[model samples]
Target: MTGLAPNVQLFPIESILDLVTDGVLAIDQRGYVLYANATAHQLLGRKELVGKNCGLPAAHGVGGTDLQLVRRGDMIWAQMRSLPIQWLEQAAYVITLTDITERKRAEENLRITAGVFDNSREAILITDSNNIIVDANPAFSHITGYSRLEVLGRNPSLLNSGRQDKQFYAEMWKTLNHQGAWRGEIWNRRKSGEVYAELLSISAIRDDSGNAQRYVAIFSDISYLKEHEAKLRHVAHYDALTGIPNRVLLADRIKQAIAHASRDRHKIAVCYLDLDGFKPINDSMGHETGDQVLIEVARRIEHSLRGGDTVARLGGDEFVVLLRLEKDHECLASLDRLLALISQPITLKGSSYKVGASIGVSIYPRDNGDADTLLRHADQAMYIAKQSGKNCFYIYDPLADLRIRSQNELFKSIRQALEHNQFEMHYQPKVHLRSKQLLGVEALIRWRHPTRGLLSPLEFLRPIENTELDILIGNWVIMTTLAQFDSWRRNGLEIEISINISAYHLESPGFAHNLRQQMALYDIPLGGLQIEVLETAALADIATVKNIIEQCRRFGVRFALDDFGTGYSSLSYLSRLPVDVLKIDQSFVKNMLEQQADKTIVQGIIALARAFDRQIVAEGVETEQQGEALLSMGCEIGQGYGIAKPMKAEQLQTWHQPAIEKTR
Candidate 1:
């Protein structure tokens, strides 16, 4: 309608309305479609709209109104605006519809976001690129104790608790700048100057050009959680009764001490201490008094040590002390102080109570063990100290402990061997050296160890000596020897058999009865079975041994004094042992050919045997010259490697053939 250039072509009103982005439709007053643009038909998904009725509100509306249009089962929002117009001289209202679906959805999303920002529990803070606070949610004001009006335009550093250094913030900002986001725990101060912990997440709001325009931080206060976690950690690591470090913490301290000691080239002592009379005190007195006493004791011990030293309770009356020392002797002074301090009477509930501490110290580098091993060694030594006397400290000896452990392991192996029938008898011939006659055979025990092969009595027997296992093995040897004797007799090879018994077994109750019963089990002749007791063993209890030998003699079980010269028993006592045979110890016999002193000792033994009216046998004869020397010394019988090595029963049968022929 107005200033149009003649050169410009004028388009139809329909084409002009179709070019508009918004859908356009014209409805008459009767709600009939008067005109519809291409966009309106496409938006409504209808091909024909000229003759159809288009629903419109009968009102003169100045502002636009929203209307819902159904298209393919989907409701579409459209904005309608009405105006009075004349169509073909008829009075009607023209209604124009515009599709507003996408804009409405965006407005709804913004409303929901705004609601979330206002009601969220986590604090939200928005800052401009220059790090000035621009906006804050209500949660931010509640958590930081700062009002929105007071915090706006201020930096987040205003709430710094100073717990974190500048480098921490520098690193946080560095991460945020590089990664566009950062999340971690941080400590901050509230408006009331109270410090608190928070789990904070910060994100950089970046523009399309990859430049940060603002920063948004979301955080939750974690101070209460942090406090609760600290309480749990304390309860876990500290003893409730004594208020000292418990075993769990003690292990950590010991490891740290070990590491420091190794690095500094110093020493650390792990001391295990037990209150000697604590159990009685806890029983006689009430538990309250006992608890008080323990607390006092723990405090005293903790204060008595150096600053770096640690005292820990391993439950009950047991406590472990970790001492870092420059020298091992330094620990001794501290331990002595501990014993004295613990011995001092503790007064509780108007009653004076006295309890002593038995402390065992295992020094690092000296004990040369791990933390657990050191503690165990100290515990073992503590028992030793308790056994010796209360109120004392004992230093652990790893070598001696190792020896005891090895002996125990070997004892277990030996016991298992006996149970599994791994023991066998080896026979060494006792012969007349001058006549080359086989007199009898001494039964020597050999263990066919599963892993270690054949083991001599010297290898495994000594550990069992004086133990109940000694009695069991001794009985086994006697029974085994008698059984072999029966076997030989059945084979027409009647030979006397002798077995060595430990002192404990000989002194054991019912020894004579057990031996008599065992001998009766076989068909051997009277005095065919002999028991060789070591001279040292007989000296253990001379009267008991003499009585045992007499009891055996009554049952035709002869006795021999083995290793004759090894014991320190008086000659008078030796004369009353009631043994029928004297076997010279191997030490003198083995060296007699080369040494005059050994030869003289051997000769003296033979003379004593003869004077005592007993048979004499020289052991460990290894050469013909030695055997000849023994024969010259008037020792007629000998048992040694020079004669014949100890052989199994099966081999002995074959070996005896040559000796049998010689005897013939």
Candidate 2:
């Protein structure tokens, strides 16, 4: 106040103090506020302060302390400092309050970050922009077996295991430079010279201009996890007992081999091998010995093949081999070697045992099939080898397999046709050739195929012969023929109907019973329904067939011997079959005119039928001359396309009248 220039007016001390950022106040010894600056009023959120008690601890001398002050119902941190001062010549003190909320928060965050960096389980490493190791955490030392002092000032590449190529590091750096961070798994060497895997995350500490200044890396050791995963992978792809590839890995190998073979225009021989006489040995000996036998067999197979080739166990005494071959003979040679080696005696537990292998091979590109198809073909061929005297190898024939597959598909279609009522019956007329009189009609089956139209019995019947379908079709024909006879009788056309039963159906278990059940369904005229049994059928069980024929005769039904000369039965056996008529096979009848032997055979059948006192019908009488010749031979009854082609039931009623007029 004494240092003043002329004409200069000094501002009040309280007003000058309000200009400072810190809050200032003057208080009496009793703690009552005497003077307060504008900042103090703002900090305390009160406009008036004089004569008011400042609710705070008494100031001890002149010192600084942190305090919490209530401002507008909110608590805030402040640095409070006091100074002993004279206010209006009375005892008082001056206090200054500085808001330090932001500083306190920043200090607390630094403490937490420091604690985390010190105690984290994950290894942390910090490097400068030049990739020089600047600092490392305790976890880094623990995981890598390197002290912090040893790593400082060195390049991070010191931990490289040399497993990754330069290009790998180049790509990683490229990603880091573009994105400011990179996270991945890396293989590195520890300080102890041991290789290990780790999941690592690296971040670039950038400045305000987004330029990288430092790199922070955090990683966790995963060596034990990798080892565990490898073990699991092996279990999945390998057989536990034999240590060879299992079925799953075999499939993968075969697929890879097929790809390579197709690209290189080579061949792969897929062989399915099964141990012969192994089950007997396994049953007689203990299962432990059986297991040992299988193990030895696997080892022999593996040793017999080339290095590139693979042998896989398909469980239980079965194993598969895949050979990469350049020629046909290579596969043969390998297969021969395999058989020889497997047949060698094995000595285990001081006992000598022998086993032979039957190997079936399907070659790739030649078979032109996928992995699964090739495996299946080889398996089928293996069975063939087993049946043809074990201890041998056979090559799969695709052509033969194709034929079997076609037959199976045809059988399936026939079954579906029966279930969907796609089958129908047609009748071909049998007539007295000399008198041109209609004798009866033979019932034939036709399949109304959805896609291929109607099919003849010749197209579908042969494949199902001796199978259950044959019996089913034979039964269907009989029932259908009986129903047609009833329909004809209702229409005032009473005619005899005959049906051909296959050899299987005639000899089936319930043939007699099933036939009796069908006959009872309609009012069949005496001898109006005839069951024509193949001559071969009767020859199968002559006594059973004779008894069946005699039993049917009691029910007013007649039986005929169909395809007569084909079976070539003896005269003594022929006389014992009590059939009413004999029908010559079409093969002999159709070619009799062209072939002398056929003519002679046909003549012999006619003579035999007559000698036995049985009526004869000549099948396949296609020409008028053939029909005349058959009549001259004392065989008057005939059926053929020359007489009348097989027709539906509706067409037959209309066709019979015209046929009778033409014959007359």
Candidate 3:
């Protein structure tokens, strides 16, 4: 049997395919079926399959049925393989039969499955191990607003927004391959042309060998969240009050601008603008007006800047503008335009208040190397402008540094001026026109510096006015004047004393109260105390000014419209005021004889005062001619060197008695 000789061996083998569900039959030559199994006998009936043809009718039910016989016109197809072969030393044909009905049914099922795959609602894509797409689902077209024809061979990047960088995609791929799935927020685009944010999950599919063959990504629209987040960021960065980016955003943006300028070898300008005279409007008129003015200020700032610039609110009357300039000259031009825009008058309630702003501009890459340094430099420059009498702008320079030190010393000296009793006031008399009687003495402030002997209101008042030190000096002027008047009252000289009021001093909420309190404390009758308001102050927030005047009026404290006819507003408005005197400006009186216009203005003021039934006094009668001209113009009350020089409290009687004797 080892390596057996084929001639000597008598080997037999049963049919190896007989166990299959198909019928097996053996046919010899002459097409006679010689061997047939149970399946074949049952399939080709006629009692046997020994003489069946290959295309035989299936005969069953133990009769000439379609399963077992090739009956007349009965047709059936069967699996049959045939060849001429020797079974027992005979030339014969051997054929086999197989029942293939189950296989056909299975093929039909596969066709149905293929139909479902093609019509699926969810996007279905089939790809090879090389990621070459072979099939796609219907939902792909519906969701992407594109037809399958357009996306058949394309990758998923057809929806890419480029919002994510390469590393973002690289990481995504790494995670998806390492794990089985990865989900994330992604920015993508639609075929019809819009970008959208999507929640996307990509899954890796592998073969039985565990090698990744394809990727499946499912995504949905998250565009709404993107829009909502944008809105939230805007709300966070911009000011609700003014609609400009707030200080927080301004700082960050300026830092960014500075960085860009540094990189590009360029320069930027930073301007710090704080509205002057804004607090008075808010404190006296109410914050409602203040907010309106702030909004208006924002509008003006936006209108003033170049298109390449940015303006932001650093909260409360403080605004900062950034100008990315191509050249230093452009920055200068921008600053000039900004100043002109801010200088225009803003009107409210039929009353116009024109306030100038102090703008401190710092040019960068030159002034400083960083944002914080530049902002500080600009802020320091603004302080210089305010110190130099305000309503101006200053560039921060080395010279400005010296001026800053000088201003510091000046402020320190002024602080001492108040702490010590270096501040004093003297009074000038007002005469009654008809009786030529001493009506009142207008209080004028002076400073007796410890070393500077004496300084007029012009010299030291600027410093006091620039600071809130006006409040302190204002109190001194009021208290000391009343105390001196009470001393005169003790001396049995019954004369009214009028004290000048700064708009800043009067607008203080405690001003009227303090005045009445001091009057009570000094035992000085309010009638013997008239308050003088400059024409400049008379024009500030007339309603509030009127209220202060009225409040003092209730205390029997009279008011005088100091320097009448010099203001820009109508004198008729002053008629509504409860003032008791009108002092002709010295300039008008000085040129009254030389200028016919001055005569007409003086006469008109005299007539206006007569109509208002108020006492009129003319200041600066330095010569007999000036005094005679005023007297001729029906301005009997005149106070100047001609009447009496401003004298000390003790010298008042000596100075006034001579004038009294001359008039009598």
* Predictions in order: lDDT: 0.86, 0.87, 0.74
Instruction: Please give the TM-score that candidate 1 achieves against the real structure.
Output: 0.89
lDDT of 2 by residue, 50-101 (tens): 7778775557545688888898998878888888788667788888888887
Tens digits of per-residue lDDT, candidate 1, 255-341, equal 888888899999999999999899998998879988999999999999898889999999999999999998766888899899889
Residue 530 lDDT (model 2): 86
The lDDT leader among the candidates is: 2
lDDT of 3 by residue, 1-664 (tens): 0111124333333344444455554554445665555556545544545544544322221222223235344544455554555656756554456665566567779988777666655455555555556556666666667776777676767777788999998998789778978888887777778877777776778889888888776666677888999889888889889999887788888899988998998988888987888889889888888888888888998987667678998888888899898877887777777777777777777766565678887888777647777788888878877888776777778455667678778778878887887877787776654465786687888888888889888876765563577787788888888889988989878988888778788887778888888888877675778877787553556787788888888888888888888888747556677788898898888888899999899999998988889988898777778777777778888777666667678778887787678787
Scanning candidate 1 in windows of ten residues, the lowest lDDT window is 1-10
TM-score of each: 0.89, 0.86, 0.44
- In the order shown, what is each candidate's alpha-carbon RMSD? 4.4, 4.5, 19.3
On the 0 to 100 scale, the lDDT of residue 134 in model 2 is 94
TM-score, candidate number 2: 0.86
A best-first ranking of the candidates according to their lDDT comes to 2, 1, 3
| Stretches of candidate 3 exceeding 4 Å from the true structure | 1-408, 432-437, 659-664
Task: Mark the 10 consecutive residues where model 2 has the least summed lDDT.
Answer: 1-10
